[model samples]
Target chain A: MTMKYKDNPQAVADLVRPAEVHRDLYIDDEVFALEMKHLFASTWVYVGHESQVPNAGDYFATDVAAQPILLARHTDGEVYVLHNRCPHKGTKIVIDRTGNTGKFFRCPYHAWSFRTNGKLLAIPLKKGYKDTGFEQSEAGQSGLPPVGAVKNYRGFIFVRMNQEGISFEEFFGGSLSSLDNMVDRSPVGKLEVAGPPLRYMHNCNWKMLVDNQTDTCHPMVAHESSAGTAVEIWESIEKDENTKTPMAMEVIAPFMSPYEFFEDMGIRTWPNGHGHTGVHHSIHSDYSAIPGYLEMMVEAYGEERAKAILGENRHNTVYFPNIMIKGPIQQLRVFIPLAANKTLVESYIFRLVDAPDMLLERTAMYNRLINAPTSIVGHDDLEMYERAQEGLHSQELEWVNVQRLYDADEDLDEEAVENGTTERQMRNQFHAWKKFVVASMEAEARDLTDA
Target chain B: MTLPTRDDLIDFVYHEARVIDEGRFDEWLELWGSDSYYWMPLDYQQDNPKNMTSLMYEDAFLRKLRVERLNGLRTFSQKPKSRCSHVLNRPSIEAFDPKAGQFITRTAVHYVETRLDDQFLLAATVHHHFEMVEDELKIKLKRVDLLNCDAAFGNIQLFI
Candidate 1:
């Protein structure tokens, strides 16, 4: 039996427009549910990196679409993304966020056990339900249900919960290169998760964070206190003759780059609400080189290939519904939607295998300074998000605007490219948000009609 | 010349909290010795800050930069200005080394930071590593570990 996907998709469709979107899209309960079902659960979301669960039996448990899910490396050495559930009873099998399950996952409740690949091993009493539905059902023996598909492109494992929407290849398409670029930067051509991520709670809808990725306009204004302050202090230090300004200042100054700088940087949006910034140059492009980072790259890939790998720096890549990656910086931030009004942003940096220790340190510095819960820059953005969440509740404003460079981007293809200041990315995102969310409902309706 | 006793060491812990709570940031700066660090770990039993990500890992440079940003007039987020209050369980003097001039104190505290109807209380265990810099007690390291360190937290605008 299938769920009667709650009717009236036009309500979802009406919320998004070419240049503006309804305030309800950011604050409404109904829209959030539609998103959780049609967009998040249906599509391929980046669950975790393969390096996180490298050895056999290592598992990383997390919530996907508000359901308990874990990525485990089976004894067979193939990684499987499975529902972190016990089929016998509904209790969660693994409690630890991440650990090795050893030989198999043992249930704390019923003494039932499962293989790492989600195959039911044995129950306590084998003859208890000999004649029941248990003998006829595949589900009884199939321990934990895996997600619809798992695509591990260069160690970035993406899982789609159900095969209701677009195929993984069609869903990702050209956007896969962003993940490729991140892995290619590694001297050994591999990346590993540094450690547990820094999770910051936002009291706002998740889309606000998604929209913020290509929102090149806000950093100069919102981070005036943070990155702007760095500039002032560095200038003060510069006035003294003997002092050379610190590397810390250089890390933050580009965020406060002028409008023209961002305009020159540019943005490119793909078909399925995926896109990237730093077309000409990213905020990361100006940083002082780490001592041995480029040397390691050159040794690995020679001059031209290493130059291309090091030279091309993308600021942020939005993989639709949830995650964003900064390829050059070797960092990823996932916006896990907790509720209509709450989101938990888990930010993690990757260690390029065999790269300079300073590169990881530099990435850590950026993570703490920009993305951490205590981040001086992130505080300003969080403040705005909270205010927007609060203000959207008012009866006054019905719609939110994303009209910057709207007209300019009209004459573009399936892959739309525009200036950094353009709201084309937001337009591209909301357009997909409507298509994914509405198409699911329409498909359900068509099913009912065909039946 | 008076030798610093346990009472004086306890006073230093309470004084540090008051300085931060009262928002006397410049005065707070005077309380730190050179090469001091303020660390809030991301996970329980987090061993080192250099290798792993932290809730915050700040040196003098970052600390000053944070203060400057908080004090900046153009920082729209701090327009209302965040304020904090420390409800401390009396400090326990863990160790006293007078010869090498080092003192260690631990305190369990409920730190509340609030601004414009948003008030969040943080349950924390604070470990302060102190060293006497020219006879004046100064903090060498302040490590704050939250009970909910593994849990998601809202943006912390003020220093703990």
Candidate 2:
């Protein structure tokens, strides 16, 4: 409450210790501001996917670290994540969420036209600026600058604005397999956007959504009201032992799985705050095989390779700052931090091209049943998130427990593996949170002390 | 039975909404046909709800499951039970084929769903297709075209 960590990065970093985290990490405005400014800028935040910008001149406008930016395909057949502001006026260039800019992006305010890659092509009224020495200035030539780093890995694009932190490969590390696993499920190892996303707003910190991904322990408890009821209803109906459960029931009932199911499933954490659950099993494991899906994979990758790709059935993969992907189900949700007290979750389902269309239908079903705003299962989680946001305002409490299974973690070279029930995934997340946010403050502190 | 009047069709639509507003799960369930869907499309121009993503495209089983979940004792989100009031414009009779035994109505509705101290209003065009099932008008398809279908929203706790 005293706000000691407002300027003290070390103190802020210390809030995230080995086992527990200070409650301010979720409730503090200064912390959230610092996270937005330093952490998201330096880290790899997912932009729109390459498939979203398939043709040259196509663009998808979004934000990174709260700065407006666009993932655009250039005329040269390359993808760049360029700042979405104009050099002349500083107004955001793209007004629409997604569209083809054709050969150039003409600003709505001024006639300043730019190439799809954000390079200034022409500016009207050049004569007005010539006498003022503005035409030859660096500001005039400077175009919509691309972010520090951009990688279109197998059509899944990611961008880092500052480039101060780890290399993209080093950041994602072994977690890259999750993306690889997702795309490889397609016969041609490609996927496309199914439709527009279902954006859900949550009145809570972005970290709560990120934390919930691998906070595997909450599902059986929080979702009991929703998915648990699905289980109860399914049980009440009598059927043959061999009869497969309805697809609708199959998707919802898994949330009521016993704690031991998740524990045995286990979780793993990578460096730079990335992790996933259901390494060997998840609620997605027993999904009845989609008709003709296996043969499609087999035709593309052959027996062993096809089996390997389909075999990697991970439930949730957290890509550090604000992205969670489900490889097996071909679903992705990104958390956009609007403010310390508000976050927006945009849920997207992908189409595994050439695979059985039913695969995508099931994914759509899963998204609607599990994540939609109208979802029974989703409402329970939303209630928890909102309540947690409200509850954290209490002055009495100062810490949130993250100690479960911490002692039993199997420390590896680049990651820590633990049971899915472990809070170790959260600990790993805060571990990276401290590194990204505190590095800037630490650097500033060093500069000050030297002066 | 005498051929039902157009007013009967209008009354049936009003009754269907009342059951949802009252949290009458059984009554709501009974209003639906055996093969039916409650569709809320994600986009205005969205033509199909089969494979593509939408806000929600729930079939009969999913509709019942949603009701059961809301009624679950452990549904903490409903501890402060959500309530709604539907103010509908007089439904226009889109089609009335008595011999074919099919009827359709289109109404614009302002739906306000509230829980605790927070509330939000949603404007939508409510479209319903009704067919007589065992001498009772049951909903064959209930489609809600929300004014902000594509816009971001919080958890829609109840049907629109």
Candidate 3:
């Protein structure tokens, strides 16, 4: 019997097992192509922050699954996600990284113009196409193609490819609460991308980064140099008679210890592959002791609510595939996949909606330590990710194990943990991966059959 | 406080470049005031230092920390050390404040560096905010506005 394209239900099922993942998933080009079509093309990918384009005619350029996309703010106060390709001759509308198009985006090639909202405004030499089937009223060929769907959660924006499946709220599930946890801390309940994001490219696979964000086992090892520096600074400050201790130093000291400190603090893996690791239980003593954070929180929300916001201590919260948010520092890192072995990570530092200047300064300091190229912590992880990419080229291993904490009892029905350093997070990601992949393949098969 | 000659200001630029090129970091540190500021604004429109974020913004304390780390034995990226040569030209004295005993000089600097056979050429606008301290001139601020601040940059091991 001939197997239909969608008939490979068994092959799709094999993608997620309780124990392991196929090695070819990472190394095979064919599998990567399938994933782009199935997973990335179906799920909602984070495009950019709404604060990036705050004014009318403001637009930011980004790429999703190799397709150039533009997120623009219309004059009417609506945000739109549209293809960057110009319909006339298919040239890109905006060539610059980011800028205001004034009233419209004018294509330099043929002088084709488009409204800030991507409506076709004018085409140079209209008489040249008099007999052509081009109609001014036809929305199809005149303007830029709109994305399948655009949704905003708070100030963050996301675009999906399929426009089907679960609603944004349903798809985010409990992870949506993570954004709330971030915004609620702000007195104004709003945050803006404070400055131009720092963009850097790494010579490693994109997945390696997503995995490392919540690994929970690498911080002490990866950041030892930074931790040591922090410790030295802290000690010197303490020894000085006239020096006052800065809260930034206190925030950096706990990270200098052995990995066991983080492992002991444990991890909480939520449903939908979202997870948090490292000191999620206790608030950073340095920050909790600060009167500025306390006063601001109390003023924004009542004392009871202030306590609730201040008490949450999530270190790194992975929003799956693309975004990893660090709540304590108010920094967000967005991962954009360039190729099978290349990734671009953009780091944005946010000033809390009504927080103190010192608070923002501390947050910026954290970003400098962790994400900047001068960072001792950043270099270590970059080296490891590069090594992982090179090592995966070996033809020896056929599967990578995800067996850590496989036997641990679960506090949440969706997660299973055997120990603090379990591989359950990896497994949860694979589960979500398999679902998106299979669903896309099944849709393609149905399209083929209908033809 | 009187304004210094344009020739003297140009000579000061060359002397500053020599201090960095020779890796006289200690002496380089002495060129700046105890409460000196270093800033690299992200955009041209940035006006106030407190409101906008910079690519590199460091007070005296953070600057000392950076220098300490660069000279520290455990700085892995600096294991082999970085060598740089700076070429300065077009020294235009933008403004001078006689009342405050300060001056603002703008110059174009072309900086080239090599570390382990990797080379980088950066063209930037260097702004010197200077003040007189006792008998010597000190830098209150040195802001470098690079043409490609947003591009993919390699490890910035040394001060630019």
DockQ of each: 0.78, 0.80, 0.31
Instruction: Find the 10 residues in a row with the least total lDDT in model 1 chain A.
Output: A1-10
Q: How would the docking of model 2 be graded?
A: high
Where is the poorest 10-residue window by lDDT in model 2 chain A?
A408-417
Winner by lDDT between candidate 2 and candidate 1: 1
lDDT of 3 by residue, A1-451 (tens): 3333234645756856766887556655556666666777787888888888989999999888778899999999988888899886778788777888877888888888888888888877788778665675453365987788889888899888766764677667776656787787788888877767767677676777887876766666655556667677657664557666655466556667565665676666766666666444522434635457788788879999988876777777777767888776678898787777778888888877777777676676666656765455676677677667778788887666777667544333364323447667767777777877887787777888999
Residue-wise C-alpha lDDT for candidate 1, range B1-160, written one tens digit per residue:
3357899878988998999999999889888999999999887989978677888888888899988877788887787998999999999999888877768999999999998888989999999998877877888999999999988888788877
The residue pairs in collision within model 3 are: A405-A418, A408-A417, A408-A418
User: Which residue pairs clash in candidate 1?
Assistant: none
Displacement of residue A82 (Cα, Å) in model 2 is 1.3
Worst 10 residues of 3 chain B by lDDT: B45-54
How well does candidate 3 score on lDDT at residue A35?
Answer: 68
In model 2, state the lDDT of residue A330: 94
Instruction: Point out where model 3 deviates above 4 Å.
Output: A1-32, A121-142, A237-242, A282-285, A288-293, A374-376, A394-420, B1-12, B22-27, B71-74, B79-81, B90-99, B132-136
How accurately is candidate 2 docked according to DockQ?
0.80
lDDT of 3: 0.72
| Best candidate (score: lDDT) | 1
Residue range B62-103, candidate 2, lDDT tens digits: 777788877778898899889998888889999899988778
* Residue A355 miss distance in model 2 (angstroms): 0.7
How large is the C-alpha RMSD of every model relative to the true structure? Answer: 2.5, 2.0, 4.2
Q: Rank the models by lDDT, top first.
A: 1, 2, 3
Best by DockQ: 2
